[model samples]
Target chain A: MSTDSDAVTAAVLVIGDEILSGRTKDKNIGTIADYLTAIGIDLREVRIVPDVAEAIVEAVNQLRARHTYLFTTGGIGPTHDDITADCVAEAFGVGIDVDPRARAMLLERHKPEDLNAARLRMARIPDGAALIPNPISKAPGFHIGNVFVMAGVPAIMQAMLDQIGPGLARGAAMLSETIEARGLPEGTYAGRLGEIAGRHPGVSVGSYPSMTQTGFQNRIVVRSKDAAALGAARAEIEALVAELSA
Target chain B: MSTDSDAVTAAVLVIGDEILSGRTKDKNIGTIADYLTAIGIDLREVRIVPDVAEAIVEAVNQLRARHTYLFTTGGIGPTHDDITADCVAEAFGVGIDVDPRARAMLLERHKPEDLNAARLRMARIPDGAALIPNPISKAPGFHIGNVFVMAGVPAIMQAMLDQIGPGLARGAAMLSETIEARGLPEGTYAGRLGEIAGRHPGVSVGSYPSMTQTGFQNRIVVRSKDAAALGAARAEIEALVAELSA
Candidate 1:
């Protein structure tokens, strides 16, 4: 029995050395997070793994085992380093081959003459895996068990997510209420804030210290599924902020 | 026997449920990556685990064992959820207590009377660990073996990194040269780029596709420890991009 009302859960495994090297700013994670949150499927975890086969296999097995759905971005290219599909297949103990369905998708873009060995690498799919259509590129993403393997490119990954997001089971929307502190150090507010947070067990209150041109500002965020409880906590927080400022 | 000159390496383990729940946007990873890169340390891998004792212990042990330095952000706070110091102590098989050094640091800001049970939580450190000075809240970070436990808050974590960055072992700076392609699809340049990358065995080239207001652009980045090799590879890449555009 599911304890959570909005129980659809997912984890993202971002596979690439480019990101680890910091040469690439990861836009995919933020994009996926926003998309999943909007669709009501809670994104539980995100892991950035290198191009290593062993790492990919281990992360795939672990995340897939834990979450209801797993979305993997990157390492599905035609290059030699693109080994995500093969590793994912190996993780599930399945044989990988150039699937006709995947080939058909790619065939639309390239002439049969132009489809070389490297290009054909994109068409490889694990057994019993279903294809998730990529609108931008003809090469489709494949799903085996709970894991959906998509391209590393942000645009294409987003496109694939847009296609798949609608089909997944989603949980209740996690609500948030934010109270902006004008000019206060987080330390000054920490004590009373902790007391309020402790008193309200259902709501989670987080103090974010941000630097402004004026000075330091703390943004207190109250999050809960219950709106009434959230409102009550927010009022207390706002009152405390006022009291502290005075 | 380090292969490359100026080779700096770090592995980051982010401990928090806030990140997993997508409640908090992780600012520490990018900040640490940028800081470490600037200091000549290549951040090789990053892991985000929840505040679970088993997970924290396992990640800390594994990362510290493999990497030159392991920087952990999060799970060091006043809340009940904050358990990184204890877990880290357990991982190292060391006894933990409210260490004098850490308490001294915190006592500077907090009055002896103001130091409650919750506040005292920040002073706990494993035996044999060195204090990592925190410039923000004065709650000191600790270093156990090669693992540096830091705060989850971006600014505080950044402050700790600033204090610690200069002291760490640094590798040769990972230099990068960017070659921008206007309106070039990554697929169009993918093959030749791969060829160029293969030719320059020491250099790593990544193709980043970005969408502009006008259209799409692909930014090719060539990174290498050897500046001369990077320049040579970059020239070849520029020539290829010019040829492709023509």
Candidate 2:
């Protein structure tokens, strides 16, 4: 049964051949993930697709349809490979052109004489979309329906996310407590942890194992939207971990 | 039209609620991406989903069906939320049980008495699957069909990747040249870059703009399996950038 009516969820679609080709390591996904979680928006899924129009379009359509908000980064630059805007327009079945509003935003950064055709490509926004202002580059990102098209550059994307952050509908904030089971291997307490998790359906328990110089430094993270359930599970888990350690 | 008959592509399925929840920043995706690119296997698509079984199974099925190979990281540890093994089995419609091979591998690190039920979970492999050895920790990751399941831990995952790297079918290695146009803005050189890309059908050109402390530090990357095309495009891009710099 659903506990909250205001369970806003989001998905991120990272569109770039640079990322897939490993020329660029993506920082936006994690940045957005952390931001959304802080704002009580559940980031359900993330998909990274190449600059190819078909891939971008398919991913955008699917993600936007499924989640309350779909944030996309990359491919809005003024290059041949930067086709995210066009792909998004095609996905939404809308006409796209140079919006005067976006051009005005660009005017702040570029002189009127310097606005070449390639520069003008950044002004192209789908029909009926609201512009998400870029404070850094003045090349505006846009929000059409549930989808937000942002710049690939981390700074610009962060700026756009900050602009849109205030307006998003939020869900119940997920509260989590992490217990370090550094010397305690997951196998030692996993069965009991599972049993505890089953008993408290509202809580989610995860065991993460990281390698240290000595051996495995494991951690158990308990999360729930309900503070009472979260606290109870945390207490039980902490006790279990303590018993195992002793 | 396909240029290389040996074009082996891969999709990465990162299974973790910790990643989506932003408690963990994913280092594995980028590591795998860089490795795949170096090995000539085009990292096509990547999807990061939560620990939910249905989501994991659906993503595994979809990614494995589409790409030449699907490499999954996370959810294979001995914990309550570690269900990637079962999900992969369900996705492939196969029976799963503790494989003797995997247990034997685990026996190298874990004592016979220490190999409890929770520890035995690591040994669970789908029928007809081959065990991918984990050199760091003896818990083995399995490769059933085209999907190679590995641990979420960076060190362990890297070891598993190293173990399996030599056997993967590789495509023609993509050669790339990066031309730094740090001072020149993207808008100034984007048109010429687009033109160069259009003329060279075999090459893939990308303009990446990153913000420096002073301003935008941009780079143009030209990539192709054909060395001649890659060279030509790189030369043209360099000329264009040089001319613009003047």
Candidate 3:
């Protein structure tokens, strides 16, 4: 049934042992999250699996099946540990080889003599997939079914996203408004906030308390796909905060 | 059944709409990841779910069953949106209310008169749980089975983690050593590195390439619970990099 809401959804699968080992702090999850939200896609889940084939395969299959789209980053490099392309193939029951399109992309950067076996690893792509160009690097990412695989490298991954973002289906943009409560404890106004949220059921209102150097400051963020509804809820929240102050 | 193998594993459930909407970049997931890894607990899957009760309940149930332990951050606050404790109880099929032990901890920071209905919401805990001391603020976290629920606030979450880390079961420490390869492209050394990784088998060695202003610099990181195995792998990696230079 066609409804007012745009329902394009996505999940991010970050494949890396570095993240799980605490050697790397994930910057890609938030990057992808912000990008998806901006493009009117609901990013429902973000999962980080290790470099292990089973872990990668299982996550790729699970996330792709549940969401409208799945985006994976990392493990598509030249290293042996970079096995995301192979894993994607196994997950979808497809064959994988050095894709000519991907190879051509790599050849743009490296001379024929320089394209060693290790370097050529970046050219492998799963069958029946379209290449997502990486302008900065010669390596290319690919998309098969609803899943798009990109590099773990942030710069390369971002370039790939820029290439693909314009082509994806988008829904109505989700809008958000924030109301600040200066020096107000959430506990002081939580009950009323709940009531306000219930009254404006369409908008999802959240209360976040940050313990600043001065004291606990509260910020209520109201979000919805409908801008008018979000504004109405924000107004109610502002009124509630003002009343609590008095 | 429990040998020298480091078996302690953990998953983090970030409960908030702020994160999913990309309003707040999750700082707790990485914080917990570092903490768990440092203490010999392998932090596996990390999940970010909205403040929706069903999402929280499902994540808590699923992650706890899969990992050796599950740590959930956020929603254990004073607001109506703060339903982690309630959802946790529902997940475990137990009744929840304002726990006396948790109330006593809150009383340490708040005067009885100031303990308003909203403020007291922080005292709600599942039927049976050991209170996790929160030194930063008086709101105590709780341990119900393998799940530890804490505040979403980074500072307070860190405090709660510190309180509980020592009490939990720890396995052999997962140690790592890093060796840098100056200006070495992964393509030049990926195949050999893969061979070295295969030979070691015990320690996990990963080759990461970072693009700096100078050129592409690679770092090989070797990790294992066994110190001797890790050292040996590190030596092999160092030798390989030296040979590549030659």
Candidate 4:
């Protein structure tokens, strides 16, 4: 009994030692999450592993097994530490080679003379994988099985996602509404909010307490696939916040 | 042989349906990363998973196996959907109960009558877990094996981290130094920086490019355990930035 729904589910695996060391603040996770949601694909999980092969392999295998699609960033660059492609290949029980199609794409931008050993490393792809077009650079990311490997750079990753996201399977669109409460401590409204949230089984409510230069602010978010349910929950939340403020 | 060097390594698992749906932007990942780094623990891997039992269980098991410590934020609140504590118990193959230690801490702030069935949900802990003191609210986070379950609220999570950080084992402190380049594109200095990085095997060099209202800026970070190597690398990086700017 397949629902044949458009809902697409995916997970992201970020590969880099630099992220772990706190040397780099990852920007791709948020961007991808936003983009995937816009395309109606739920980004279910994100994992950041070092450039180590075993970690990458384990994450790749586990995420791939769980999600309908998997998107991996980093470790596909030309540097020596870029081992994600190899690890992904190993995880999928496939072989990797400098694919003629990938090499052709690389050769389109860089001259054969400029394509040094380091640059050539970017052309390697797992066997039986299709290329994910990269608009920023000629060197393309590739898709093997259900896994799509893309660059770590935000711009490049965005471009690759633009090329591949449209073709992926997607589910029902998730909807969200936010209600703002001024100068409210979370403790003041947490109980009533919990009651309202519990009453609405389909809606998921989150309380975010933000600090401004002036004072503390709480933003409550109610999200659900059912628009009417979301509206009802939002109304309750607004009423509760008004009562608390009064 | 205990190296006497405190070696603290942590992996962060972010649990929330909002993150997966892209309804909420994650502020907790960066905050926890910065906190762990400042407290002298190597913040290794970060995984963001949906509020699903199987997904949470898989991530908890994998990360707990790999890291010396594990910190999970989100899904530990009083809501029915906040299933992190239960999922964690299943992952560890242990029973969960309203732990006395955690309930005692909660009792200090919450009135005995006010500790309703919903409020009591936060006190659930895995078998044989120790409470991690929470300064903001007396309801403490509990540690079962290496996994320390914490709240998703940035302020509350920070408070719990402050309490538990000192007791954890830490590795040799990771040190970093920065050299700033004015109005430099990464490509301009990429080759030279790669050469310098090659020269110093111990130092991990990363070039971060930022755009300001004025112009572009590139910050080169040199990180290593060895003080002498780091100093040398910093000098070379400064000189390189100067040369590039000139």
Report the number of the highest-lDDT candidate: 2
Q: TM-score per candidate, in order?
A: 0.84, 0.98, 0.96, 0.80
Clashes of each: 11, 0, 1, 12
DockQ by candidate, in order: 0.32, 0.71, 0.59, 0.32
Query: Which tens-of-lDDT digit does each residue in B1-246 have in candidate 3?
Result: 012344988888888877877888889878888888888888878888777788789889999998889999998888878889999999999998888888888899888988988888889888988889888878988999999999999999999988888888987888888999878778888888889888887788888776677767789898888888889889988998899888
Collision pairs in model 3: A74-A152
How close is each model in CA RMSD to the real structure?
3.9, 1.5, 2.4, 4.7
lDDT of 2 at B75: 91
Q: For model 3 chain B, where is the 10-residue window of minimal lDDT? A: B1-10
DockQ of 3: 0.59
Chain A in model 1: its TM-score? 0.94
lDDT of 2 by residue, A1-246 (tens): 113456899999999888888889999999999999898888999999988888888998899988899999998988888899999999999999999999999999999999999999999999999999999989999999999999989999999999999999988888888999888888889999999998889888888887778887888888888999989989999899899889
> What is the C-alpha lDDT profile of model 1 across B72-127, one tens digit per residue?
99877765557899999999999999988888888898889777667778899999
lDDT of 1: 0.80
If you assessed candidate 4 against the hidden native complex, which CAPRI class would it receive? Answer: acceptable
Docking class of 1: acceptable
Tell me the deviation in Å of residue A67 in model 3.
0.9
User: Which regions of candidate 2 are displaced past 4 Å?
Assistant: A1-6, B1-6
